[model samples]
Target chain A: MSEIPSKWKCAVIQLHSKPMQLEDNFNRAQGFIRKAAEAGARLAVLPEYSLTSWVPDDPGFADAHVDREYLSKFCELAKECNINIVPGTFVERHVDDGKDMLYNVAHFISNEGKILGSYTKKNLWHTERAHLEAAGNNPHTVMDTPLGKVGLLICWDLAFPEAFRALIIQGAKIIIIPSFWNLLDLTEPAFQRNPRSEAIYLESIVISRAFENVSCIAFANVGGQKESGFAGLSQIAMPLMGDIARAEGAHEQMVIGEVDMEVLQDAEESYKVREDISRPDFHYPVYAKN
Target chain B: MSEIPSKWKCAVIQLHSKPMQLEDNFNRAQGFIRKAAEAGARLAVLPEYSLTSWVPDDPGFADAHVDREYLSKFCELAKECNINIVPGTFVERHVDDGKDMLYNVAHFISNEGKILGSYTKKNLWHTERAHLEAAGNNPHTVMDTPLGKVGLLICWDLAFPEAFRALIIQGAKIIIIPSFWNLLDLTEPAFQRNPRSEAIYLESIVISRAFENVSCIAFANVGGQKESGFAGLSQIAMPLMGDIARAEGAHEQMVIGEVDMEVLQDAEESYKVREDISRPDFHYPVYAKN
Candidate 1:
């Protein structure tokens, strides 16, 4: 096995995303990239649909999005910052079968200004199912990089452990989540009264997922206003230790932390936790036809 | 489908056990059952290995452990209290292939003094793997009860979402967990610095698991003292409201709450969440040969 990196600095770019606004989002992303570069980070992540926000209102809007200029700009940002970058997610417009199709694609940008590989979100949220195309037949993968094997997931995909475990089995040392987790005032009376509860739920899940998998999870979430609320508690959590850096509320901020694998010796060897699930007794419904 | 119950009250019996003292354990369990029955709880849950403390110090002890009298007292407690009971877990002593084997079993007792069904734990925690036998070939089943389709899960099984999701797919209305989550000062510097972090991680995961599945979860955990600490925090969590009733810290206490189907209308109809995982873009290592 390759020597686990002793020190790996990462940054999360949390933004106050304006829905359907391209220039505003791009400029804001550029600022975060610049800040991350200044902080000497080796890897950086942005929130889901960082350049366009979430749940597109217009169908035709994705047709012309993320063209040559947009794609090159991200590649250039990675090159300029000299950091491996995950530019949240972009609505990739392309031709599938005989018709037009758009998928939410999370791309891994190499430090040398090249697109390494990408993962199309398989699990689409209820709101996105009607608005976006799902990667129904796609295979899961881990993006190989100098820092480590990085697993990528979009917003709603966080709800499924199957996706995360797949990446871990394929040797994912770090998992990156780009979430537009804006938990608004729901019609449910209880949720309405306790608006911040959703954020708390999310923050808790992030820590548990990281500890269970024995990998570093970098979560980047968007910041939203009061009416269209966002429970923006983005964090970087490591195995067993929980969150080292956490952003609070719907305020635009940047969270930075070092994800060091050298520190996980006690967890990996003592428990053999990853091996705990190796037995054949468990079941997964994804493969179940019924 | 059977009509979802309008309101169902449940109880979680937390204990600070004296290992191997079956009388002390049973007497304590009886006291809690009596209290829950008085509080109008139709269903009561006890912690894992409630009949005896975990990892039998001596092998011969199992032969004399769960006698007919001990078993009947639990059943009689359920019958007397007039409440359905999940007696946490009993270390069932049985002979297989002319050799003695011990298995941890979670039993469901009917209010009418009948054995409704039982679930043997498939996933054994690392501490117990060397000391106890695993349920490799056992078929998973949700206990059919008057309250709801109660799916049973033990501690350490909580880390594996695959097992949890399987229960949800089988139409589990309320998932019951019996955990003995004891926190200790870790050798790892980070986890050692903050001992209560594991409990925090667990609390977060419980809330998310319930909300995501749209199932009510009744968690029962044991209490612990200074050196060998237990992060009790046993809770009754619902779809969107998070924890309605939670036991704070590692204190022996009974938490009671009504699992109401009326309040879940907003969560169930608006999002066909279980259907969100319908597509086949997933992976599971349990099926992996290697």
Candidate 2:
């Protein structure tokens, strides 16, 4: 095994984004990014819908609300800090013909103020289905970056293994998920919701996702009491080391995670998850066509 | 909300097979199955290679050792107990065009002394590749039983999500895994290993696999000190209940798990994991063939 020089540190920013306030959101994001840079983080990540309070229903919201400013600001911040950044998600409006359609798109920006790629969350929840359109084509993307092959996903994508496998097939070593995963409790008091078990559910998936893929995962989520209140167990999990760093529940915090190639290599060698996958065609039904 | 009559209880038999002593192994299995029946289990499952101390490097092992008696005995046991039994795996020698090849096949026996179906494991680990063969044609099978749509897989198949997804697509409400998941370690005595941490890794996958697929999982494994000391964390995790019961590490024990339709329904209704999988086409690459 060759000895590497320095470990790549990643930062997950858990923010309490103000409702409908773009200026304050970016300001908060900027402060966190600067702190992450000072702490020697080469890559900083934010949560899904970090700009505003979790998007509630408003038909004309996408057409009137979203702007190009968020992208420019994120690019500028990435360049200023000399670090790659995933600045959460924006409600993007697209014209398919004469109609305005909305999508939840996450932008990946490099340290050189260049847009690497963007991916829309394919699996939309019950609430999101009312307004946002799921991606018309493939939603998974693995962009080659200086730090690693960064795969972008958002929120509910964690529930789907196919998303991760798609990226892995395309050579993703690091998977980044920007999530606004709220504790989905029933609105009425009489509904009988189990309040305490949400973290167990979310955290279990996070740790297993990293373990099964044999890749580094950056799961960033929003903080504070919103919706049913976000379960802010924002974490960065390596292949072998379960959780490098994790945020407290519902607390706005910035935690650093070290992604070392050696640990990843060791885990892969020990488990042989990738190497053991000899017949991907048999497991994956898609390959039957050829 | 349907008021179901009685919960279907399933039992996972964690065993320690005596090396090469086939009679002693069956006697052990018979005792566990009896105990499971006494404990009110409708479906009883055993660990992979539970009939022998896991197949070692003996080229003539399958041809010389394996016989029809094991199958007849298991079928008789299932009939005697009147309980569905997945009697782990057996090394069966198959001759195609007069050539002898070996396969580790999991046999599904009905409660009426009839062989329901048999499935060979698809994903073979590094160690098994030396002696065994990877499945060639349609390795995935979901057998319909009175208890549930039972999906069969063994050991290392847990590492692959496609196996689970393939079964889920076939309407499997309960997935049964007969595993001989030997504790993966550093292989050298010089490399320090933490025994306690293995359960956490195994249990996490069990819980997440159940949650993601919205299906109940019956994970059975061998119990004893052998290859890297089998991590006997055999568990039954419901979609909502997580792990209803799990074996203590490396302990020879039998545990009961309730596979209630109401619990499964409630979990699906609340989380909507099955319903919310809208973009299966995009997420699953195989759907692109159409």
> Model 1: what is its DockQ?
0.41
> Tens digit of lDDT per residue, candidate 2, span B169-244?
7777788889887665433321232343345568688888988888889999888864556788899987656788
List clashing residue pairs in candidate 2: A286-B286
Docking verdict class for candidate 2: acceptable
Which residue pairs of candidate 1 clash? none
Tens-place lDDT digits, model 2, residues A1-290: 12322478999999877777778888989999999999888889999888866646544346434567778988998898888899988888888769878888888898887989899888776678887888846546688777767788898888888778777766678899898877654232212334534566677788888888878889998887644556899999865567778997687889898777566666676677765443455445422122
Instruction: Report the C-alpha displacement of residue A187, candidate 1, in angstroms.
Output: 5.8
**Candidate whose lDDT is highest:** 2
Compose the digit string of candidate 1's lDDT tens values, residues B1-290. Answer: 24446887889878776677778888888888898899899888889877666646766456545565776777887888788888888777778899778877777887766778877777777677776787765656676787768788887777767666777667777888888777763455655645766676677778777777777888888766646777888888876678888887676778898877654555655445655443253333222121
CA lDDT, candidate 1, residue B27: 87
Measured against the true structure, the TM-scores of the candidates, in listed sequence, are 0.92, 0.90
**Where does candidate 1 stray beyond 4 Å?**
A1-4, A64-66, A185-194, A278-290, B1-4, B185-194, B263-265, B277-290
